[model samples]
Target: MQIVKYLKQYRIPFSGLAAGKHNFEFEIDDKFFDCYEHSLIKKGQLKADVEMQKQENMLIVNFHITGVIQLTCDVCLSEFESPLDFHERALVKFTDEDWNQDTEEVLVLSKTDYELDIAGLLYEYANVRVPYYSKCAEQGMNQSCDPEMLAKLSSEAADAEEDNTEEQIDPRWDILKNIKNN
Candidate 1:
């Protein structure tokens, strides 16, 4: 599909590189997230700096990703930008085996493969950095929840509590109370 072709820029062709350190860079934006169907991060402006060290049989890749991602505040339901800076390392091993084994930090590639597609790895790295509970006050710089929204929520809660107190009780409970008083 068109989406898959768009992400091909992340592939690194290491077959011809010498056994030394190599550097590559990529820009991540909203369109990058669109390639994924269910991406946690919808929008961001990030730069991925990759340093790959190629050896005789393996490659060690270090990723330095930095940028700001748009996140919705859980407390106030407002949109805000949260800065992201993270480092992750991945090991790619070349093997002749028929079966391919891959993990979060390790990858096994067939000897015949000439390029390593890193779009998925980059997506994973960016998504994992998001907090489980996102709040503007905590994640964003000098940011806080919306005062008007908080006030409206508190007022609605108070009104609900008042309505509950005005509800009529069963007459049997009152009879039981009177008997207990006696």
Candidate 2:
């Protein structure tokens, strides 16, 4: 498929490499997110510095990711860019078993596998760096919510409160209140 071809660049062909440390660099941009159908990060400009240590039985990969992604403010819904920097490590082990075991920090690949596809790993690293609560003033560089939008929201709330106060009470309720007072 087209998706596979696009992601081929992220595959590291380790079959012929010397058993030692190797360094790789990748540029992650808006097009990178297009590969994922439901990615939380839609737009970003990032770079990934990867260090892979290959041993006889296993490979240890370290990811250093740095970039800025566009996020929406929770308060005013305004879009802003937030800087991201994080590091994560994954362990890949080779096995002959048909059923390979994998976890967040570890991966099991068949001994016959010649390449490691890192596109999925890179996607997870970037998404996990996103904060649970995103606010423009805090995450953005010296930025705040839209003042005009905030003012409009406040005025709408005040108008709704005023309308509630102007609603007439039922005559039946008034009689009940008078009886209680007496």
TM-score of each: 0.91, 0.89
For each candidate in the order shown, give its overall lDDT on alpha carbons: 0.93, 0.91
Residue range 1-182, candidate 2, lDDT tens digits? 88889889999999999999999999999989988999988999999999999999899999999989999988888999999988999999999987555888999999999999999999999998888999999999789999998898899999998877666444666687899888
Candidate topping lDDT? 1
Candidate 1 CA-lDDT value: 0.93
Tell how far residue 180 is off in model 1, in angstroms.
Answer: 22
Off by over 4 Å in 2: 167-182
* Pairs in clash, predicted candidate 2: none
How far in Å is the alpha carbon of 42 misplaced in model 1? 0.5
Candidate with the greatest TM-score versus the true structure: 1
Per residue, candidate 1 scores C-alpha lDDT tens digits across 1-182 of 98989999999999999999999999999999999989999999999999999999999999999999999998889999999999999999988987555887889998999999999999999999999999999999789999999999899999998877765454676777799888
